[model samples]
Target: MTKIKICGIKTLNDALAAIDAGTDYLGFNFYSKGVRFIEKEVCAEITSVLKREHPKIKLVGVFVNSSVDEVKNILDTCSLDLAQLHGDETPEIFAQLVPHAFKAFRGVPTDITGYEHKDGPAFLVDAAVKGMYGGSGVTADWSAAAELAKKYPLLLAGGLTPENVADAVRQSQPLGRGRCLRS
Candidate 1:
């Protein structure tokens, strides 16, 4: 079965709702500039409760260009399970969080030389909207992503919705789908 990640959760209610809906993963934005950015304290509150109530759900912290130490601090305090490096973090920076971190590449990455993240289960794939990191509602190239999926698991993102998600899943064959900002 394909796992689902409901990202950009800001409140306890939303978190619980997604959890109840059987989403395997949940993402909390830590990027201050992102629309879904949640305050550290607020995120802490939400995760603390979730940690006690639903320990099975994997919690991912979304970060962009933040220092590895900063990300570690938050993940430690919040007890998050994984770090989704949604920035230009070097392989060195990513290695610091090794065994618990995964890099995110915008659009169809042509060069994955230094990444070599075969250790981790999957990688996040999203549209490379210029000037926008993610949550752009711009669909990515599924054909390219499907090809990548042949190598490893993919966390398919970018412009996913209830209506088209099935098609996206069928085409990309991702290990999971990360979705947000649907209306």
Candidate 2:
């Protein structure tokens, strides 16, 4: 079965609703710019509640160009199962957090020539937005992503809803190889 991750979650009720919908992963935006940004204290409370009430749901922290220390601080405070990097963080940054983090790269159609990075943790290829960090609700070129997915463990994101996710999964099956979809 394809794993499903619902991102941009805000309230605990929404989180619960996603979980109830059989979502495998639940994302919490920590970036201040995101509309679903949650306070650290609120994140802690939600994490606590989720851990106690719904341990099956994996929790992910979405960040953008944040320092390692800051990421660690959030991880220490909340029960994050993974850290998602959604900025221009260097490979060195990904290396430093390897095996314990989920490094996400926003995908764009401009060449993507020098976008190679050493394979560390699971990576995501999300649709690129002009002036936004993420949550653009746009889809990337599945054909372009196919080439990259050949060498890396990839998860697709951006503009995905329950309606189109199945088709997206089918189109990305070659890249994903039956892996779950995350949007």
Candidate 3:
């Protein structure tokens, strides 16, 4: 079955609502430059409550080009279960945080040789927007993502909505799907 991840959760109420709606994962953005950036303390408080009340729902910390240490620190402090590196982080970084962190590539990478490993980290395929990390609100290349999904456990992101999610799922067939629901 395809899993669901609600990204950019800034409030406890929103997080809880997403959980109630059957989201398997909640992504809290740590990218200070991004629009949905949430403070560590605030995310921590939200995460603490969520962990207590909804332990089964996984919490993901979204980072953009942050150092390995920074990601690790934030994940530990906020009680996050996973990390989504939405930048140009090296494979070595993923290696260090294996099983805890994964990579997000924009528009699908031509060469995914080093990134793929046996039951290792899953890759998130998002729309490629110049000078942007993510949250572009542009539809991703479904055809390309579908080709990649044939090999790896990809998480389809970018431009997913209630109207088009079914089509996206049908086209990509990813392990999961991520969308930012700010309401």
The number of the candidate with the highest lDDT is 3
Q: Roughly what TM-score does model 2 have, to 2 decimal places?
A: 0.84
lDDT of 3 by residue, 43-101 (tens): 99999999999998989999998998999999999999989989998888878887788
Residue 171 error for model 1, in Å? 0.5
Tens digits of per-residue lDDT for model 1, 86-144: 88888889878877888788997887765656654458899899898899998988879
Write model 2 residue lDDT over 1-183, tens digit each, in one string: 456777777778878887887777788888997777878788888889999998887788888999988888897798788788888877777667655576666673343333344543256777777887777777766666667666665677767766777777777642231112233
Where does candidate 2 stray beyond 4 Å?
Answer: 108-121, 174-183
Can you give the lDDT of residue 162 in candidate 3?
A: 94
- For residue 115, give model 1's deviation from the true position in Å: 2.2
Look at candidate 3 and give me any clashing residue pairs: none
Residue 159 alpha-carbon offset, candidate 1, angstroms: 0.2
Displacement of residue 68 (Cα, Å) in model 1 is 0.7
Clashing residue pairs in all predictions, respectively, total 0, 2, 0
